[model samples]
Target: MGSLFLTACGNLNSSSTSSTTTTTQSSSSGYQTTGQSSDSEYQSVIQNGSYLTSKARGVGITQNSENMLNLKAFESGLTTLSKTEFSPKDYIFREGQLLSKSTVQKWLSRKSSSNPTGLNPKDNGETDADKRNPIYVQQIEEQDYMKEENGKLVLAGITIGIGMNRKDYYQKEEYGATYTTTISKAKMIAEGKKAAAEVLKRVRKLKGASDIPIMICMFEQAPNDSLVGGTFYAYNVSKSSTLGTWKSTNLQSSVLPTTSESTAINDNDESSFTSFKNKIQNFFPNLAGVTATTKYKNKSLQELHVKITTQFYSETEIRSFTQYVAQAAKTYLPSGIPIDITIKGSDGDIQAFIARESDSSSYYTHVFDD
Candidate 1:
């Protein structure tokens, strides 16, 4: 929450900014100006800035401060925390570890969208309130896992920060590029993993770090579009050029707190998601969009969640709409796969309804989101 910017996009040995003030530009949508978070009223503390001043907070010092490590080309993206130790010895304290601001927002401007609100506001979900203020203070500690290196323990992993803002519709740039919202999901995933592979690009400049494994937390959010538009993502980034492991949490169950799933799916798989989305878009008219994923247990598919966003006029209309979606989706998916449908009106609360293979046993529920 403190520092949201990616490691200053280059060699870790790059020139350093002595001041606490760090400038970073977020991807702006339908804005009066470009996607510059550091410009306008938006400002953020660099993640490394907090790391550089960790000594002031009594956080552990990195093995080497002056030496910048270089990263080799590798596969990257987000994943759950797997090979990390939470002990204090594994943390790397750096300068500016005491940056004041925990989150940075550009609320002075509005991005036009088809949403009923007509304006898209980006929120960093670090706090529970909607307060819109910034301060220059933060106390942060960076931690990594340790591995044996030539008979010695060394810090060997890093968490690469990536965020996906939820909106009426998600827009992203092309691979290897920033600020272009005209790209496909496949391209976005590929590009994201590519970026993740370079987590060491800047931190390696720190003498003590080397061949660090990367973890990604892709926080994708949208404005009440569906259960997915208001949730968090957890992924396990791999260092061996393999796909990252992943998962997510949805808060929309607040609207229907009695819901639960039988099996969990990999929320990060793109191909499965795109296929289900295409099916809904083709079957339903006025489809705002969809977010679908499959969950696996012990390497076998067990559960499916299909979250849909569309237009509806009233309670009866929404119920009928959900009936058709849940039914069709239940029929469309293969046999025995427990499917749960999370339906959201263009700007309404998310209602969860479980659909089974029987076709006669579907009911909407107040699914509890944990």
Candidate 2:
């Protein structure tokens, strides 16, 4: 009797589809061409086309999609500046500064919610919903102050603002609404310092990895216009360091920034399957097609499973070698398969199993555990 085995073959490239627009770029330096559009509305220093069309004039623009959008903007902006006979370095500085301030204004406006009175009946009675009191809040919206630190160009500092409670309003039936103004300058300053410290730590690490610049943007707002508040931070990993190792704890939070990495896989599953079948055909020239079978059984606690055994041959020594047989079988095995060979008498047996549980659009192959 020969060893029994099960195997499965799948097509890998069946899921791949063609795209209409494609841009080729050198993958080594990270300056890959990411396509361009001729539409004037989408035309800008950014090659993506969407950013130029979406961005409003005179408004501060922060890099949105990590290095992809930012690198595109930086490179394109440099090209635009050079063509116009302007200094690229000066433009970066000037634009960055202006954008920082605009971002601060945007942060402040966001703190002003539609319902500031806290008159809504369903308001949960908590510190956050204390409309009677206003808390002093300060924050930096954006900063891009670049300076040389330890032989590396680093961006330090940040854009921030503070809001202090101007008054406390209370209900007085006869006199209508009246309140007293009370502001906490100490609290405002403390929060600002804390934000600065955190931002500084991030800046230091970013500067250390100058090869992979991290662009940082922060936004803060009053929680329900009450004395409570929160902050938001966004950062992008530069294209220059895309292949390097980077860690970002900020991305774990729901409100913070995130990043992505992409890769391509070989897509020629049909040909691969055909090659596999041809190899198997040569191994057992007279053997019929293989079939898959599955068996399942349940046992009770009292019953013990018994083993059955059978023997066919005593012992004999005989051998024959064929390079073609070995080559054909090896070529058909998947890249990750582990092969173990054994011989008895004059016959050879290959024992292995291939289990596939992938969908039509994807290919997944798993070898059975011995």
TM-score: which candidate is best?
1
RMSD of 2: 26.1
Tell me, what's the RMSD of every candidate?
Answer: 20.4, 26.1
lDDT of 1 by residue, 243-278 (tens): 356544221111111125312233333344454456
Cα lDDT for residue 361, model 2?
22
lDDT measured at residue 117 in model 1 versus the true structure, 0 to 100: 20
Model-by-model lDDT, in order? Answer: 0.36, 0.27
Give me the overall lDDT of model 2: 0.27
Model 1 vs. true fold: TM: 0.28
Worst 10 residues of 2 by lDDT: 299-308
Query: Candidate 1 overall Cα lDDT vs. reference?
Result: 0.36
Question: lDDT winner among the candidates?
Answer: 1
